[model samples]
Structures are given as structure tokens and as C-alpha cells.
Target: MELVSLNATHPDHGGKSFQKAASVVLHLLVIAALTYQIRGVARLPAHPHIDARILVPYAPGHTAVVHPPKPKIIRPKEEPKLAMKEPPPPPPPSSGGDPTGDADVELAMASFFPDPKPDLAALPHGTRGDIVIDIVIDQDGKVVDTQVDQGLGHGVDEAVLAVLQTWTFYPATKSGKPVPSKQRLLFHFERA
Candidate 1:
């Protein structure tokens, strides 16, 4: 018999050639892939299945009704009203505080005692001192007796006494009876 070539010759024009070893490798990969596919299909279960789940809402068949109580009526009590009295007007600002030393005495506008020193022509303005005078008043509210307890210079004592003579006080009373009362008078003399 004539010698026949067993090698499969690959066509080549400066191209790659598939050797015998490379062709054997490709055939082995294709057979492995087909065999794995067939084995995977055979391992599956005989019947196909689908999972199912159900949800339902709750319903109340019966419920009792509730009613609120009615509100009660309230009435205010009758009260007798008394007549309102208006308070006396506030005292003038010129007068000094609590001069008579008696809170209950109603001196009104005619009250004595200066917050500032009174003017004295004999002495210079801004002369600072006080002249105390003991005043004795009869039941008639007239200055009956006068005595100087202390004196500030420049005849201020005489000037204060002169003013005291003209003053008419509310005669002091004890237990509703007019009584002779003596009160100390302070004459404050300050500069200007």
C-alpha cells in the first residue's frame, strides 16, 4: 500500500497553526461542557413547585355604644352691696412730713414745719442750724406761752417766735376733751 499522510494539515499564509496537542485540548473542553450540562439536567427534581402564602384582615362582629352624662346648672348667691366711700385727697407737696408728731391730728394745709430752712434777713443765706421753741397752746388753739429751747444766731429765734405767734394750732385733745398741750418747734435754717 502507498504511504498516506495521517496528519491534518492546517492552511497557513504567515498565520498561526493548530498543533496536534492544541486540537486535542479543544476537543477535551467541548466534551467536558456537554457532559456537565447533561449531568446537571439529570440531577433536577421530577416535578416543578411554586410556594404560596395568604393574608386576611380581622373584622369585629358587634360593639357596645357609650353615652356621656348631662352637665349640671350652677346659680350664684345674692349679696347686698354697701355704699363706697371716696378717700380724702392727697396732701400738698409743700408741707413736710408728720410735723405735729401725732398721726391722728388733721392739720391739713395749715400745718407747720418747713422741709427746707426759712429765710432770715439778719444772717447770710445757707446758714445751717435749727432753733427749737417750746410752744404752749390753750384749749382755744392759740399760742399762749413760748420758750426757746435752742437758738441759731442772727435773731432767728425771735423771727421764728414771731411766726409762731401768728400760728393757730388744732388744740390737743385727750379723751375728747380739749387740753393744754406743749410741742417743741424746730426751725431749720440752711444757706440760701
Candidate 2:
């Protein structure tokens, strides 16, 4: 015959007394609960009877009646009588010649020049710069586009462009007729 001992060197092997105490306390609690429940049941009276029935709510004697809406009657509209006014007399033939009258005239070439120097304001004191821009002229001899070709930094360039916009441009002509053209213009600005 061989004997087997359950004790081991590991720490988990201890606490046998604590485990036994916890088990005893739990068993006592369960037994006490069962005894208390049984005593309450003994105190109750013998046989009780109960009855079940279906219930319904009370309703009113009167109910609502829905009615359809009446159709609308449309009245006819009367036509308005327009008074005939004599057509206004044809206007006299215009003295101003029509622009398309001389279609054969070829465009005449002309150089662009500013009638007067552009006004520059708000320039920084003692600032000096030159701005070069390509100006586009329309057939009516007006500056259409003032694209900056070479610009001076700071607000000087903006001032120059603003002034150039107000200046009149001489439109290039071909065969004596005004035509659109692009020309390079330089404005030297100096603040004294």
C-alpha cells in the first residue's frame, strides 16, 4: 500500500483553516434562510379562492357624421376694349450716318500716347519707380486692358495701374479706320 499526502511546498497550499470556516458560515446562512421561510408558510391560512373576469369600457350614445365640401362656382372674365391710337409718325431719317455705311474703309495705324500724365496719389515719400504695362486699345480709341508687363513693388504698381485706367489711349488705325491694338507703355513715377 502507498500513502499520498496532499500538502505541497507552494504558497497556494496554505489557508486550510480559513477555507473550512468560510464553508461552515455559508452552510449556516442557507439553513437559517430555509427555516425562516418554512415558519412563514406555516403561519398562512388554509385554502383561498380567486375569480377572473373580462372588463370593457363604457361608450357614448352619439357619434360624429362627416359631410363633403360644396363645389366652387367660377365667373367668366370680360375682354378689355383696346382704343386704337394712330401709330406714331415714322421718325425723320437720322442725320447721324450709320457706322456700317463705310465698310470699305481700311483701318489706319496710329501710335498710342497718353493725353496727360496719370495722377498718382498716396505714394510713399521719396519713393521712385518705373512701371511698364501693355495697354490694349479698343476700336473706339479707349484703353481696354492695362496688363502689367514690368511692375514696381509696393502700392506704387497699383497706383500706376489705377491712373493708367483713367488715361485715354489713341487707337491704332488700319486704312484710316480705328482698330484694336496692344502697345507697351512705361510710366516713371517719382515722389518728391
Candidate 1 per-residue lDDT over residues 1-192, each given as its tens digit: 988687856567224444666778889887665443321122113334633222122234533233233556676597768899999999755422245453433231224532433357777766778788888888878888999888886767776787778777677765455667777867667666
Estimate the TM-score of every prediction. Answer: 0.38, 0.35
**For this target, which candidate reaches the highest TM-score against the unseen true structure?**
1
lDDT, residue 64, candidate 1: 29
List where candidate 2 sits over 4 angstroms from the true fold: 1-127
| Candidate 1 lDDT score at position 5 | 85
Specify the highest-lDDT model's number: 1
Give Cα-based local distance difference scores for all models. Answer: 0.62, 0.60
Quote the positional error of residue 22 for candidate 2 in Å: 99
Off by over 4 Å in 1: 1-121, 124-126
Model 1, TM vs. native? 0.38
